[model samples]
Target: MPTGTILVADDDAAIRTVLNQALSRAGYTVRLTSNATTLWRWVSSGDGDLVITDVVMPDENIFDVLPRIRKMRPDLPVVVMSAQNTFMTAIRASEKGAYEYLPKPFDLKELTTIVGRAMSEPKGRPASPAEETNEHIPLVGRSPAMQEIYRVLARLMQTDLTVMISGESGTGKELVAKALHDYGKRRNGPFVAINMAAIPRDLIEAELFGHEKGAFTGAQARSSGRFEQADGGTLFLDEIGDMPMEAQTRLLRVLQQGEYTTVGGRTPIKTDVRIIAATNKDLSHLIQQGLFREDLFYRLNVVPIRLPALRERLEDIGDLVRHFFMLAEQEGLPSKQIDQAALERLRRHRWPGNVRELENLIRRLAALYPQDVITTSLIDQELSQPAPSSLNGEDASQNLGDSVERYLNGYFDNFGEALPPPGLYHRILREVEYPLISAALAATRGNQIRAAELLGVNRNTLRKKVKDLDIQVIRSSR
Candidate 1:
């Protein structure tokens, strides 16, 4: 059999030489590119059948290279490599449809095996799990992305640092936080959760700092704040981005001084809490916008962990589906096996919501779409509607999105593997328009003025979208 050709791309000269020798010794023709520019040129020029690329190549956003590579050869296999190996980069590769993701320090045998198998196929095959109709969330696949997430979790088990998990709303930020806490030394402590956005602004300080018997009105009795409640435990601050500036400042003090006092109490109380704050917001962006404090950002994000969005880490779908399968069974649901077509559809989806979304979908499938094999039709019907929040604390509107994004970017230096879909402007408009229109209509009870304040959008703009999306508001007799 003729040796298949391998294209290796990275900015490092030494890596390229080593890879060339390694691949050459393993019985393959090796070609090289120093950066994405040269790499793109070679791929565009129809250079080789199998491409291996470093994500952070000079002069290129490899994240953007996926579509172009597919455009050139839709079936040509390509493997992405990265040193940073962040959730965003892995997820980006998945979104852009890479054949496989290989994080740095990879074993030689694995690379050879992947390339040999890819070249043999004569068409690209994404490194998705082996197809089965089983409805279990198994955390499947050996993809580097999944491995890296596991690696991070393992490392976090050793540290007591305040972790900040970031990802999209459905990307499983809470799970990451839980995994760290459970695997870490604080496994036995109470895991107290407080969603900053869910609570009213005025009460947040009181909730976090605790209040004296008569600190403020309605202070009927003394109550412990999350800090005190979570003494010697893990305090998960979900949607921490929505924390008021005043609260943020105080939290920063607690983090810095390792203590806090009740709202009205002058005596300082020491805290032995491990914080694992999560958000989807761009805290840096918020900082630039003067909404999020820089000091607090650094304090909360001592150790950042990024969770992969469902679409960003599509390779893990099989494992996730399998995991969800066992999940449904445990919850007393009938068998919810997903067939090949359904799995493919799950693979193709944009999954605006991440793993949490997928988990919810799986549970719903198990509960509602019982046995006889889950199909693409089922998944399509599910995706057609707006995804609801899991556990139903608060609907993951823009605020939830903000927190997930913050946690994701905090750990994963480079962002998602997949670029946002085409028509981002339209998608954003719809995102803004639906809520704005719905809120206005709801607040007004179909009246225009009341709806506008609830949405903070001018009635005229709301009217324009109502016209554009054909959203009808029923006339109220009020």
Candidate 2:
């Protein structure tokens, strides 16, 4: 039942023919062109109901014509197709008011569906264009995983929806969040980030919602919170799963009411911050343990984006390596080129620490190595050595004690010339207990009796710990 004229433009006749055939089969009248000028003429003449155009044309770029089309025929939805398939390409398409951006070589069925949806949907004004910038591309990679992420990010750039990004550590969750804020409608607003794990649990509430001079025993001057600072912008809550229950409650209230009160302050302060929360921990597991509020999770997970680990997208390693080298060159490091064999070795190795680990290795190769070309042997040598404990990617040879000691050392080092907030003993115990108990449960196949016996604790105590720590108990018959 698809009706109306579909305007198709592309430099390639084959592509135009294919689109014409597909759109005609979909029961739509199709007019085809090989350049943007014809598409613009059709739109300006009010001849086409929907416009499907390639990014680059022989005569004029579709991007240049898109804004004019939007101004002249705002109701006509324009679907942009491009073979470029870069992060910036998707962004540009969205910015130019394209209803949807389809990376070339896309499925014919998907294209038809998008056209149908666009045609049926109420005609509304597209998002207002944002100011252009050539800031450093924060994201790189063209694997299907990355392409999907780019598409999702492009659609989200104009909206203020809350986003929850989940992935392993070093998967560039913060980079994605930064991209969201930097390209979003609130680009002019401040982007404030607070790590839930880094701050003491007791201070988290005050840190998030500000504190009056007499809020607590500190009796310090009034301090503004991240919410206040990120007003009209974005607030990225990293390690959100580590947020304490009290802080979670306060955060839930803010999300619900769009207003909050400072500690010891009676006046309510309204906020307009787009919350972008990221976590490596399984929040559903935390919710099962009664540690995280389920209501808050739904509020922040309005747009859930799970970033793939570097291991999941090995095809992107070459691009990532080149990007890192370019960054290193910009930093005045010795220029380095990685050989094919070296890149193959990288692809074979398990990237346990994800992209961050790879970036560090690249930096080391660029800075420490004397050779212009990185070789397989050099890669093997570096991969064989134990990752430094400081990088938090220690090798398997490192025992729990050594890892704990290194962590404590770093924790203390972070507070040089100062003392850490109180309740360190309990916090450290909880941190150690979570993994230990989770491991025990896994070994026991989620049998509480067996796990408790293994841990030399009573079954009730083990149950309490499990619930308190928010460790997900996956039951299996092994």
Candidate 3:
């Protein structure tokens, strides 16, 4: 049984009553208030062992009062509750020294657990708040899925943990990375991003760890690598699954030793940049295929954040659509409103391109359409137009050559003037084989012979692939 007093402040009488009941039942003496003023009085008088307050209050915003309370009673754990549930709300709660930030409509049992945990733990001074910024919203959507992400991101904003973000393309991996860097401890440092898929395999090492002049045939001048440039900041390795084995080894060494040697240079340079890698591909599958290094995967998988696909969170489509419209307006595009029916229609979409696809649709609606309010008909026409096939080569309506050519065109477009690094054939083959073989194995349920037959390959060749790919085989026990 708990023995300390728990002070809770909320503007709503129902909330106060409910919390009072819950905490009292949990064996704590509960003091409830409908305003921050009374809560401050209780805290200033040192009357409570724990504090639960909402972000908004009748007399004052709790954010303004939290710092004063922290200074006066550093040991009192303050848990923040809010109905807003936006990314900023969670971050503000963390920055204001809240022990935990629970969104409104949170589970009562979860709240009690958090309170109990706070009470049992030894009280200590909270982390000092980082420099404040009134930057534009870096993320949008208040769906339950997004709320969970916001909570995780808030907790991570103050740490230097290496994060691995995996999601479908256009799912805002880069935005999440930027949010981490923009609001994190290293906000002041530069955020450098490198796309492994976009860069040639041979050039990846040099691109990441800059080359010394005269080291290679084309070496002209000593160049700083992303590690050197992002020293004290973050290095976002986009499409990390596409990184070659040799480069993966070098990256693993850097991660292990906290130092790297510039290509064609001897002295080891120490670096202090946080690593945040993102990939749309299935890295585990890649690992099984012996493409990605298992050691490197473990190093970067320290804090994995798998973003939910757009189709998985259809509830957020409305919010995302509105956010994109607002952005379009800010960029001198005409203002647009999407009808509820249109939003519902959007929810039904498979959204193969994810948020990026939705954003493009919204942008086009704002730019091309003459109407102020968008209707289901407009959405119908847009969605009806043949969406360029997914790069995964899933749509069989197009010929293989056409699909490969389209994908290659886009891949080449990523580099404006310069051509992609050499050795494109092996890369393309690996990309195609990865999905094809995985599909065969999945359909056959890890039966090598069946998979080989399905793929029309010899059993021995399939066995070698299974070994070389390190693919995990789970036999069905039926």
Candidate 4:
């Protein structure tokens, strides 16, 4: 006797044969069919322990039949296979209540394991109505890396799991967050995003948890924070690694108690908002450095999704380029097409700034180039120019000064007519010194001597500063 009767459906005879053989070899009896009609008959008659069906079939659409199958036999698990392999496809499979979704060219062993699990596991809830999507897709690319991300995001859309997205800057972390909110159960709710790095450190709490009138000198009226504003939706905390330690403590409390109070309000407001945080920095490293709270990290990292950098998914560069081109045209830029050679050239270069960098380059090409078609030579010329960071040596310094100026202005603004506390010089210097020294040490591969030289300070002074600041240094081979 076989372990179970498995029904396999695919338009391709070769695929049906492959699945039939694979399942048979795994000690299960397999029934093969090339159309959805036979598969539905088997499912409706309760003749099969499990059903594996392709999305596209000759006579019937699988997605259309899946909900009916679920209605007739709610306990029968249906595994969906698709060659389309887009994010929308994965979402549809999930929304239609697939036991598991396998993209084409999947590993045979993985399918077998899914089959075993699906047969043994208890029955799941019936399929929910599929959510409608607009024309705009927040994420693109069908690369294997992106497919995995899509599968994870699809599963997460129906739940309120707190997700932490870790990736390098400009890797579309915000886009991922927005997608989760737009397609999730909270689709009808608002999505409020706040950049931790953009706000002054002292004001972070007020920005997140709101403030009452007369809470501070700047509070002329009551203000609702991101959390209160997000109410039944999602609160996206961008650059979460840049959050001050004090705010992390407060955030942890909110996550723990599911409620929070404003800056001067005594009444605790219940919070029903979902949290989705993104960070380019390593939270583990920051935790070790005592910069990030470990407890808060655990709270927000319940469902962690690490986005792949552009270099890791070069296969999707062509798709991403075309997407940007379409977006540019929609924005009133001249229609432009990139030749195959130019696209290949783009794939060869290291995209240090990731997708955002590519998007900017595409927009620039569409705006600046006169030709309707872009060539490899033009691509080379655009890429040869120094990156925005390297365009001017003073850019970094100017940005740093501007950030400091903005913070000071906010600080003064908060005080109204009053001056900030005494010892302002030392306080500000210490704040600047820590990151500057840490960055220098990181740049020098933790070589104290090299860091000291780079900072134009004595080695002894650098060592003492490192000790005082508790900056961990792991020296690398010179």
Candidate 5:
């Protein structure tokens, strides 16, 4: 066994000496740097198991230097140290890719443990998700957000740790989980899924753990459950938030012990399946409500991925629509064309149901719209009468002219064969600009200063537009 190598970058000689001795004592090789330039050099071409660098290194600020360093060593786990820690600085550092941020004067034991964990972490290209047997349900989007998701999924593929996916309903949480299993190192193995909420309270355990013949009234012959079926690959538990409390205890024990007997069998059957659980509800809150187990929560949450909602990443809608359309066309449906107007209309609508809803809408358009044009007018009609039962009255339909104008205004609306008249352009632009400005402002927590920076305009300019367009800003937890 080779010892781990740690790169220590700090301006203070005392701190460097202390870390070096501490790491050396813990059976690690220590490489030292006194400035950001040397730190950058080591990071550029050198390989180290871990990096511990001071935020206020001489020659350059860590924040300004990190972007380039990240480009060189993208998977490198970095721990940032700072004597002057502020919430903003801490957030910025973590957001940039620093694995952990520690305040100055950290304890030796803490340093040793954190460094050890970082070194042992899985690194390199994550396994590609399992190739779809049927490409009809492909995940789409080339937006920066989707690209980020791809990067994360790729990294996760390198490790077989349990993963917990959190997203609102209709955000395709299951799709993300499936992607993890498909591209991961376990792709060749079976992938089994079950809904914890869908099963009756008395049956979740039986659904997970196989039952021997005569285990219970209906247990004729032996039965294998999801865990057994996915023993060599992945087992996905959806709606985990709704899992029964008693079943949660059993599941937690199985995760910790890695072996479980069938419902009525005496001998234990070991499984090597990777567990991927998802939920639309907030599990943390459930834990507080005493309906979930803390130990179980921590075990399954070894890796957490937060999926962004469709409304949160509207820029990707254009690509998703096209992907869904391609899928529909492959199914023998006539290909549908969406002009810039229809695309914009889709983007501006608050997608409460997220990408899944968008996919359904696109498929409906492909299947039913009379003409290949798929005009904005058709979209308006569909929006007004859409899955009334499914949406359950969350639909807030805009007036007819405004809806038509919103779609016709965007540049990409040209894709549809029948374009809206030029006269509607100015009004629609104002409508689009007003809502966008309001949304950004709302996302910034009503901070006029931050909102202007995000909108790429002067504060005074944003203020004038807010008044001119009658933008109503709301407070959001941005």
Candidate 6:
């Protein structure tokens, strides 16, 4: 006897035959149809043990008939298959009470496994109504890599699971976080994002958990932190690996107990926020180096999602370039079009800064080049120029003092009213001293007297400073 009867619907005869053969070989009776009308007739009459339907049918859309099927047969399970594999499609399938969603060209073995699981599992509750929105697509790309990400994100939207996104800088970690929050059940709630790397080490806790009026010397008034602001929503902790060890401990406690206290308050406040943390660093390495807490790493890495770099998904470069071009035109930049050769050139690049770097290059091309068409030579010319962060030889164009001042300005901007860590002068000087002495030594070919003269310091003082900074000396030929 057959294990169960499976209802299969699709407009394509080839797909129907394939699924029919696969299901029949697996010891199940399969009923095949090409239109939604026939599929719904069988479903309404409770003729099949399970329903497998395509998103688009010749007679009607499966999504349009899905709610009626659910209302008529709440116990029946439906697996949705789609050729239009997008984030929105996956989300809609899930929202319409799909047992599972399979993108086109899926493996036969995986389909069988999913079918088995769906048949054995108990029936689920009817899906909640989907939220309405008219925002632009947050993520773009139809490569296999992006399709897999969309599937995972779709499954995660209904729950409050803590997601840990790991990727290189500029690979759109925060964008993924925002997509999750924007499409999730908490869409009505606010999304609070804080970059641990941007904030000072000592102030990280206060920034996350708020502070009492008299929390510390500089606390003139009570303040609410990110957790309070994100209550009933998502709290996105970007650059989570940069969080100090002390703050990590407190964050772990909050994750464990679902509550937190102000910096100087004794009363614990309950939290109803979903935690989504992201990092560009290797937390495992940090844990091994004693810079991060292992317990905290485990707490944050509940559902880890690693985003692929641009080079890994080079097939999507053309789409991304077009998207960026559209954005640039919307922002009042000159309209520009890239030729095939120019796009191929982009695909060949390593894209060390990933998507953000590509967007900036497109913007630069639109602004600098007056021509409507962007060619290979123009792309090559723009790419050959040194990146903003690239440091040239010893005599780099940017002055050391000016660079330090700019870094301090950014650091101070991270904290609005709070002061930076104590011993600012010593800390800043110590940071600058090592590099200054090292460069001077390298320039003078490790000669103590000449290096001292170049730095306008005494030879003995240079030796003492080198010893204190642990500089390794290499003497060149005389």
TM-score of each: 0.56, 0.80, 0.81, 0.81, 0.56, 0.80
The parts of candidate 6 lying over 4 Å away from their true place are 125-128, 133-135, 389-478
Candidate 5 lowest-lDDT run of ten: 386-395
Rank the candidate models, highest lDDT first: 2, 4, 3, 6, 5, 1
User: Candidate 2 lDDT, tens digit per residue, 15-87?
Assistant: 9889988899889999998877777878888998898988989988888888888889889999999988789
- 10 residues in a row with least lDDT, candidate 6: 386-395
Predicted candidate 3 versus true structure: per-residue lDDT over 1-478, tens digit per residue: 6799999899889888889888888899998888999999999998999999998898899989988988898889999999987899988888888889999988899999999998999868565583466657888888888888999999899999999999987788989999999999999999998766545467889989999999888798898889899999999998898788999999999999999999999999999999999988899998998989999999999998989889989998888888999997887766889899999999999998788778878876775555789999989987886533333444553666686687578656745676644455654564466556666776776566778887889876876665444343443434
Q: How many clashes does the backbone of model 5 have? A: 12
lDDT of model 5 at position 260: 86
Worst lDDT 10-window in candidate 4: 385-394
What local lDDT score does residue 121 receive in model 4, on the 0 to 100 scale? 78
Off by over 4 Å in 2: 388-478
Give the Å shift of residue 326 in candidate 3.
1.1
Whose lDDT is greatest here? 2
> Between 1 and 5, whose lDDT is larger?
5
| Per-residue alpha-carbon lDDT of candidate 4 for residues 112-153, written as tens digits (9 for 90 to 100) | 988988877777655655655664767888888999999899
Error of 4 at 197 (Å): 0.7
Number of backbone-clashing residue pairs for each candidate, in the order shown: 38, 0, 2, 0, 12, 0
RMSD of 2: 10.4
Q: What is the Cα root-mean-square deviation between model 5 and the actual structure?
A: 17.0
The segments of candidate 5 whose C-alpha lies over 4 angstroms from its true place after superposition are 1-138, 386-478
Candidate 6 residue lDDT tens string, 1-478: 3489999999999999999999999999999999999999999888998898899998898988888887888778889999887777888887777778888977889998888887877776556454544347788777789888988988898988899999987788989999999988999999998877545467889999999998998999999999999999999998888787889889999999999999999999999999999988899998999989998888888899999999889998998999999997887766889999999999999998798779778876765455689999989987896433323456564554466677578657744576643455765575467667777777777776788898899876886777555454545566
> What's the lDDT for all of these models?
0.71, 0.85, 0.84, 0.84, 0.73, 0.83
